[model samples]
Target: MYRKILITTDGSAVSQHTACAGVKFAQQMGAEVLALFVAPDYQYPVYVEIIPPSYPSEEEYVAQMRRLGEEYMGKIMRSCAGANLQHACMTAFSDTAALKIVDVAEQEGCDLIFMGSHGRSGWGQLLLGSVTNKVLSHTTKPVLVHRLISEPASG
Candidate 1:
């Protein structure tokens, strides 16, 4: 049913697990995949002398993050073998990752999004809302959220 799929990765285990699943889904549906990695804006304070301030410049930190992101994306691309799915990776340093996912999907004409949920609960979930939650709440496209960690058995 899906012609194009968008998969967002933060280089987490759950994200990688979901990526594997997405590759399978894309293969089954004969769809292309667009994988994205967002470099969060890690800002630092500016300094004049050799003894720098507590925080580094936002520009330098962001560049470092972007380089790391690119390396991670390279690994992701190299890992996808035998699926024969057409895929591309993108890195956006300053943008909100959730929104970037949506924007890429729209730009690529994606019909489906495959992502992983950490399944945070109670206070944790409340305090640190997940990207999956945001994407689900905001997007008009169909999303499949995979729970990476299996739940404990009940009595």
Candidate 2:
């Protein structure tokens, strides 16, 4: 019943797995896919401690993140080529990635969202702070979350 589906990815194994499910679902439903990757804003002062300030300027770091996001999103699209599904990719900056995904879904007029329960970083799940949970709480759209495994929370 969906005409447009939005799938979020981060080039992780779980993301690829999620994309596969999304692709099959989209194919069966006759829907086009919009693959999106929202790079978390990396300009905060906190990042100075995480990364060397001399390596890249704050602006350059954000740009690099966006570029990597696009490349990862593109990889997702390429992987779906065998399915012959119509698709597009987008990249945005947001510290709140779940909210950004929902925003993009609305902007793209997508009927459904498909994404991994956690991206490559795995920090989301590690902290019981899954992006899927945030999106589920914030949006009315249908979401399919792909989980890599069943694990108890670790403090």
Candidate 3:
């Protein structure tokens, strides 16, 4: 019964897994998908001798992250198209992805949020501070969290 479904991706396996299901769900509901990729904000290192940062300037660094966002968004858009689902892609820079994701979902009037969880627990969860958990805590809209099953390491 969702009109708009927002899916967040970070090019991780878990995120992609979540997206695959999200697309199917959206398709079934005839809902439009909003594929959003949030890039981390770039921070320039303090100059020791003004050797010029590798990116040269803050503008260049931001541009690079934006490019990465676009690339990831394009990949998701292709999958959405394959499912015959109408979708749009968006990119944003934020220090905290969870907060930004929740804010975007509210601002865009999305009915549901589908995202992947890293499936961290106990000390891991406490130390890493899950984005999905934070988003769940903040958002008022429906959120579906998908976690990929961990596979045993190859010998």
Candidate 4:
């Protein structure tokens, strides 16, 4: 029933795997897919009047993040190609990834958001805020969260 699906990735193995699955799902539904990678924006060091020599300039940071985004988007591209699915990919620089994801989905007119979650619980989840959780909290659209399940160890 989904006309378009937005699949997000962070370049992690779990997210990559989830993105591939999302592509296949989109294919099955005859829906177009938009793969998005959100890179963190450059942050200037605080409390220091003078910028540190070791810190990268804004141009350098953007170039580095663009390279990383391409690397991550490449995997999604291959998956879409293999699935024979209609797909497009983009990269955005935003420290608030959840907000960016929601905005992109809305702007692209995507009916579904498919993404991976580490599935942390208890204190861990509390300590490290989850983008998936934030997206869920913020968005009114339907979200399909794929929790990465560890494979059983071979004896």
What are the lDDT scores of the predictions, listed in order? 0.69, 0.77, 0.77, 0.83
Which of 1 and 2 is ahead in lDDT?
Answer: 2
* Candidate 2 similarity to native, TM-score: 0.79
Which tens-of-lDDT digit does each residue in 45-146 have in candidate 2?
A: 665567654676777887788788777776667756767878888888888888898999998999999877765555644422367788999999998776
Q: Tens-digit lDDT track for model 1 on 6-102? A: 8777765545666777778888998887777777677443434553664557766877777777765664565455677777777776446677777
True lDDT of residue 82, candidate 4: 82
Per-candidate clashes, comma-separated: 0, 0, 0, 0
Clash count in backbone of candidate 2: 0
In model 4, pairs of residues that clash are none
> Candidate 1 versus the native: TM-score?
0.75
Top candidate, metric lDDT: 4
Ranking by TM-score: 4, 3, 2, 1
**Which candidate comes out best when scored by TM-score?**
4
Better of 1 and 3 by lDDT: 3
Superposed on all Cα atoms, the candidates' RMSDs to the truth, in angstroms, are 4.9, 4.8, 3.6, 3.5
TM-score of 4: 0.85
lDDT of 3 by residue, 72-126 (tens): 6776788789988889988888889899999999999899998876523455444
Cα lDDT for residue 65, candidate 3: 76
